[model samples]
Target: MTATCTWRIWGLEASLTVTDPHRLGEARSIVDTIVADVDRACSRSRPDAELYGRSIRRGRPTRISPALCTLVDAALDAARASDGAVDPTVGRALVSLGRNRHLATESGRPEQAAHADGTLHVGPADHTVIRRHGDMLVVPEGITLDLDATAKAVAADLAADVIADEIGCGVMVDLGGDIAARGETPVGGWQVTIDDGPDEPRTQIALQGDCAVATSSTLHPRWRHRGRSMHHIIDPATGLPAEERWRTVTVVAGRCVDANTVSTACIVKGAAGADWVAATGLPARLVAADRSIIGCNGWPAPDRLAA
Candidate 1:
């Protein structure tokens, strides 16, 4: 029997499910710890949070927790994979766009964003001491890190794996719409509902064993600034919202972080987005600003009969 519960977390909703209903409590506890660790390490809004207003400014090495280092590493990997389409160095750009730590509508101090001259860098391989220090992160001066792009997905992936390992059962963790699964597959596998905001067509898909699904959309989490519409997905090149060639993009991958990375990058890739995702060969659904759906790389067609 699959048991699940929902609650608010990280300014979003989180759902946890365990194949063995009795393990729900244990699973939830594990997930709670994972999310707390992430928030404590990566929160940009909390004054006391490790990353709050923390900038290296001038290629200086800064000390951070191992957990945060791992998260930043993932973000950098995403940026590298997407060719800077999904950048972790856009924190200051976001601030310039009026997004504060709370993601509130109020404008923020522009000085808090990553500087125009980007010189961000990471430490050497795991356990290796680099030119400066051991396990020390060298964030360029004025480069503020914002791991928001992959934070929730990281939490989901981490929670699912930890819960399954600790409880010896199948588990699925969904942070907002970023979902991850591990261990045994339930009776019908993992049925995921893809909904990108209101009035948008929705669909369901199934997954088995370990897998992940995530969606990035421009329809929601938007606001008006300087009398112009804006969104959270910033194009590092322009230091502004992704030009909305595609309104939403969802991808399924072996991991939630990868899925989110590709999906978010798809939004920023603009006209070449579909082709870009198609090249990755991951099944994905792209919805244009006009709400027209385009399925690629084996994405299930809505008109096709379910077999």
Candidate 2:
């Protein structure tokens, strides 16, 4: 019997497929268990989630769940590699930009304001401190963290690994457009559609065997703040939206976490990001804001799809 199911988890619609003459029921059970576990581990809105606990607590390193720890550790390493181009402690900035709600929700709430006296640190892979003085939550001189950019990728990787191990079949996990796949599938590779904002042409990417793919673009929802349009991809150096250079960047790497992490960093890196991605030897496609496309290193032009 062949069965497929689609449900929302980790802020995106996750589709699971299973094919087996026997153990169809068992397959469904395993998929459901993975979805539930991923939701509990990565849902940012959940106040009790390990991520939230760490974020809410000012200077304390709360003991995180193993799954959450894995995600965080990956994010921290990415932050270091990018020289702080990607950060995991930008929850406060994301909140301030009115993106404080879960992706599945229809409405968003304004981020609570930090205490007036709060000071934040902004640098590459350094200890950050935040303190509260009376009504103000100070960032303790200079410390900034933004993990929203990389957390989704980490979660996708974790979900894919967990699903493949438990079900012993192919697993495709997508957090928004970022995806990771493992095991074997009926099709030669998974088919992925890339949304390049509005009124622009969409592209497709194929993943075979084991690979992680992540797409970062400025075309997502945004709002005007201080007379400038603000997007979700924050630059840790300036604590502001990244400058518009490429409209979108899609990267394929050995792991979903790396793909997702580098994609976000590439957005902030601008034209220089192309060189950076090429140097890493990962296959990547970049779409400029002008609609021109460029392929880097091992990545081929969109016309050439691997079969």
Candidate 3:
């Protein structure tokens, strides 16, 4: 029989499902340790985090831990893959839009809808200040490094790998909406429910084999600043929240990091996102502000496959 556990850490909810009931406790411990380690290393809210420490260096590369280096590389890869739409260099932009701090500290609901009323401000994308050379990294002075977009997803992938390899069993880890599974999956695969609004019927999808899924939405974490609407997902081209027709996008990929990267970038891509998603050949489901749905790539037909 399989066992499942859920806990809160780093201001996100994490769920773990393990194949061996006997190893549940051990698996949870390992996950907890990994989560905390990743938070310390990646979270920009933590002034003591490695990402923050090295991001302040202006001209010189600072040596980082192998694990941190990997995370940084993954983030950069996401930026490159999405043509800067899912930019890691948007830390300054995020902070200016009031997403620089830990969300839990100033929270209403955990995932509040992100919207704004002011004119969309267009600005140039931030220059790439983050550079990695071997195990060292560098960022210009005064540039903040916010890994909010990819760190949790990467952590989920890492935790799932750790649980399956060390515990010698299958496992699934969900950090917020970013999910990853390895080893054996439950019968019919791992079912994932997608919900992205204050009140909306949920949709379910299944993941078979070694797979991951992630959702990015503009309806969550929304707030108005100085009478202007703002959200966390920043368009690198314009340095503003993407005024996309779709409010939410869900994607399935071989890794949680990749899924998250695409989902987020799609939001920034706006009207072109559906075609871009199709071009990438990743199955995706996109929901518009009015709740109309569009399926792209290989997203399952609604109601054809029961979750």
Candidate 4:
């Protein structure tokens, strides 16, 4: 008995698949609760969000809720894994580049692309100084935190875990494009359609065992800033959106958080991304701006996924 449920949450589409059809309702409630909790704790655009308020009043140590703590830790891990390519300390950088608010509603607006005035200052990973001990987190007086890269994926992982344990059945959770699954898998596993971009052809993959998949793209969440096209994937070093190289990158990893980390970092890494993704030994698909594609670490060949 298998069933699926899809809903809108936190400005993204969320879907839950359960092996036991009778447990679908229970699974939906679990995922909804998890997403709401995560949004309240860590949403970058929510003024009332815990992360937003804390970013405003930094300097002293603040005790965070378990959910926020988990997200912060995940962000830190992503930064460390990618050697700061996926820094969470870029919150101020994002705001300076006109990303302080939600992009889903304001995308493609020049007003949403305010010119950055000052130099974007973020030092090496060690000197950046975001310290965490248990649930306590401390940052520089003016440093803002943005965990958008990993937060949603972590939320999906949490939801999948809870649904599988509580219902004692196989479960899959997809928040936006970050996906995680556990327990039993369908005969061919979960079939996932990968969206390369508007101009590129989409492809499909199957997730077997306990694994996760995530994709980061410059094609979406885009806008015009100062008469130039911009996107949401900011490079911390420049405090600006990454330049066009690969339109999108998708990765498969043991956890959704990890997969998202690699995908986002690859976008920031630019031309060196291919080598970086290869080093990680994960299957990945990278689509160039011209719609040309690159496969790494054993991803399906272009002929196999061509539009």
Candidate 5:
């Protein structure tokens, strides 16, 4: 029998599942520890997080924890891989877009993302010195690192890997929509539903082996700033919310972080997203604002998916 648990974290849903019922609690513990570690180090919202406050001040040249450093590295890697379609320096841009304060009283929830001018000190991380490819990290002056695009997916990967290895069972970790799996595949594999919203078309698919899927959207976790809609995914080239060409994009990859990176980049790539992710050879599903589906790299035809 399988066991599962669900809770809320950082204002998003977090779920864990294991093939062995008895190991469920242990799996949760492993994920909890991983989440806490990441939250402590990478949360841009936390005043005391390693990437916040004085730790990121100009000319600080701080040496961050390996975990946070690695997350930043992954964000930078995604930026390069996506040709700046995904970037970490949008933290300052988000602040400029009115993310410096909590959401307006009507929302009653903490602010998540906003539009930006994309005025980032963009450069190679080469100046920061990554010795031996280690997690050592340094943020350049005039640049504020934002790991919102990668940290959660990386944490899900880490938690799933650890839980499966230590518990000796198949495991799945879903941090919001960034999902990961490891160890054996259960009967019928891990069935996932791609349901972007009430108005969006939906489908179900099964993942096999050690793999992951991520869904990056223009709707979920969105907000209104100055009476205009805004989303979390930032297109660094424009320093603005990605145009809603595809209302949501889902990608399947060997690792959750990689899948999320590509999916988010697709959102930023807009009209060219399908071609870009298709070139990567990973399967993906992109739903347009009009609810039409665009499949790439062997995603089943729209007629084959659940309604």
Candidate 6:
């Protein structure tokens, strides 16, 4: 039994598939519930969202919902593990880059601008703690934290897990291009197409049960600003758009959150990102700006064109 449904959520076209014939509606309902919950939990545009409320209060320890708390903990852990390369406190920088508004509906083109100096302290998970000091204002009043980098992947993983546990069937959650799957459906693994642009398409990826995949690229929806083309991925160290050494990087990991974390880190790491991905023993595909394709040792190349 095969059924598919698509809708807009988390700033992208989300699609779900369930192999159980009798549970099609159930699967779609579960996906809808999860997407709504994720929107409530992570949306920065909402005035009353926990993150937005916390951001407005400025430096005070605001209590967050359990789901958001979990995401924050995951993000902070990733930041520590990646040596601050995947910092979540770059919200201010993102806003200054004209991403302060929601991307899903905002039609204005990307614009770049210099940002004020400041630092934000996230938490010990128990309380918001100011771990360091910097010149920039800490937590600008009314600032919104965009979890575009990680939340959707987290939602996909969570939704897949919950659906499988409750319905006793396989589940696949695709939030934009980030995906998570549980149980089984496809014979070899879920076939995924990697798109770099119209002219260049690469091999399909086979993702198996209970795994997550995420891709980060400097080419998507990017625009020129101040004599330089800037993408959404920002380098925390420089407080600027990351240098585009690699056009795209994809990572497969044990969890969607980890995949999300590492994929974003790869963009900032540039050419060395491929070596770092290799050292982790995780499968990865890297497309350089020069159009060279590189994959981890075990990643299979597609027999036919991916497009």
Give the range where candidate 5 is weakest over 10 consecutive residues by summed lDDT: 102-111
Model 3 CA deviation exceeding 4 Å by range: 54-59, 101-123, 126-128
* Model 4 TM: 0.89
Which one wins by lDDT: 3 or 4?
4
TM-scores vs. true structure, each candidate:
0.87, 0.77, 0.88, 0.89, 0.87, 0.82
lDDT per residue, candidate 3, 263-302, as tens digits? 9988888888888988989999988878788988778887
For model 2 the TM-score comes to 0.77
Worst lDDT window (10 residues) for model 3?
Answer: 103-112
Question: Which should have the higher lDDT, number 1 or number 3?
Answer: 1
Q: Candidate 1 on 1-307: residue-level lDDT in tens?
A: 8999999876677788889999899899898888889988887667466665344434457777878777877887887899878888787667666677352213333433343434122211111111224457775544556788998899899898888788999988999899999999998888888887567878888887799999998887887766778899988777778899888899999999999999999999899988899999998999898888899888877765133
Q: Tens digit of lDDT per residue, candidate 4, span 1-307?
A: 6798887766667788999999899888898788888889888767778876644354678888998888889999988999888988777666555666441121122323333543334332232588888888786665667888889999989999998888889998999889999999988778888974555757888888899999999988877655667788888777778877888899999899999999998989999998999999999998887878888888877566433
Candidate 5 structure quality by residue, lDDT tens digits, 1-307: 6788999998888899899998899899999999999999878677677776464444345666878776777877877778777777776556545564421121211333322643322232221322213543445455556788899999999999998888899998999888999998888888888876676788898889999999999887777766677888776765567788988899999999899989998988889898999999999999888878889898978666533
Question: How far out, in Å, is residue 95 in model 5?
Answer: 0.8
Clashing pairs in 6: 117-136, 118-136, 118-137
> lDDT of candidate 6 vs native?
0.68
Regarding TM-score, does 2 or 4 come out ahead?
A: 4
Question: What TM-score does candidate 1 get on C-alpha atoms?
Answer: 0.87
Error in Å for residue 201 of model 6: 2.1
Clashing pairs in 3: 112-221, 113-219, 113-222, 114-222, 116-229, 117-229
Q: Which candidate number maximizes TM-score? A: 4
Residue 37's lDDT within candidate 1 is: 94
**Residue 184's lDDT in candidate 2:** 74
Alpha carbon lDDT at 190, candidate 3: 82
Cα lDDT of candidate 5 equals: 0.77
